[model samples]
Target chain A: EPEVTQTPSHQVTQMGQEVILRCVPISNHLYFYWYRQILGQKVEFLVSFYNNEISEKSEIFDDQFSVERPDGSNFTLKIRSTKLEDSAMYFCASSSILAGVGEQYFGPGTRLTVT
Target chain B: GESVGLHLPTLSVQEGDNSIINCAYSNSASDYFIWYKQESGKGPQFIIDIRSNMDKRQGQRVTVLLNKTVKHLSLQIAATQPGDSAVYFCAENDNQGGKLIFGQGTELSVKP
Candidate 1:
């Protein structure tokens, strides 16, 4: 089965530095999303991308966060300035359709550690 | 402001036994629900899903039951195995764009 893939399985960055997480969603997928989970907290939605634009975003996805589909296969999330609280497991998910019943497949996830 | 939550944070069962994980959702407008399994150091893997119009849906070794009236969802695993040990989460879709709201998740441990 085809699955979503992400690069840099783990990353360590200094506070105030910029970080970009990359993901290659399933080839045929049309919708992509980013979510994060604090060490012991529930997974939280960050942003959704479709048609090379942001479809939806949460409050946590503030000025520091931006998502771009630079190429046909690559989707990226960039944080302008990282903070200690930004350290978490960032996951990339994709779906072929936009229906509510459609199943979204998740990637292995990139663990971001800020110090 | 709606959320999905699991009743039990953890559940343990012997290998070959059946396991059931329960969840409660507060969003009455949610029309889609999914069950996902997550192993340590990995992202959630989709298991099964059910629509609000359907009461039950089954997969290879899993079954999902959705009670729209009470806003409850349950995942049943038959003949649980050691590989089934992981954190299971139930998510609900708002029927908008494919955005999903995930629950706190339940840690399932299968002992052989």
Candidate 2:
């Protein structure tokens, strides 16, 4: 089965540096999303992208966060300035269509560690 | 502002036994629910889902029961195996889009 794929399975960056997490969603998928989980915390939604634009976002997705679909296949989340709290497992997910009900397939996830 | 939460933090069951994990949602408007399984460092893996209109749905060795009246959901796994040891999470979708509110998660350990 086709699945979402993310690059840099694990990332380590300095506290004030900028970082980009990349994802290649399923070729035919139209909707893409980003979620994060702090160690020992529930997975939290960050933002959703469709038509190369943001559809919905959470408080955690503040000024430091931005998402881009620079190409037909790549969806990326960039943090302007990484913070210690930004250290978590970031996941990318995608769904094919909006049929009132469809499953969102998740990637293995990129573990972001900020020093 | 609504949140999805689990009742239990951990559950231990013997291999070949059944397991039940429960969840509660604060939003009555939420209509879609899903159950996901996550191993140590992996992402949440989809298990089964149930709509608010329906009371129950079954898939493979798992069954999902939704009680919209009380805003509750549960996952039942039959004949659990050692591989079933993982953290299970219940998620609720308000249906506005694809956003899902996930529960705290329940750690399930199937003993051999």
- DockQ-based class of model 1: medium
Q: Write one digit per residue (lDDT tens) for candidate 2, span B6-111.
A: 9999999999999999999999888889999999989899999888889999999999999888888999999999999999999888889889889999999999
Q: lDDT tens digits, residues A69-91, model 1? A: 99899999999999999999999
Instruction: Pick the DockQ winner.
Output: 1
**Candidate 2 regions off by >4 Å?**
none
DockQ (0 to 1) for model 1 = 0.79
Q: Per-residue CA lDDT of candidate 2, range A1-115, in tens? A: 8989998999999999999999999999999999999999999999998997999999999999999999999999999999999999999999996413988889999999999
DockQ of 2: 0.66
Error of 1 at A44 (Å): 1.0
- Candidate 1 local Cα displacement, residue A75, angstroms: 0.2
lDDT of 1 at A9: 99
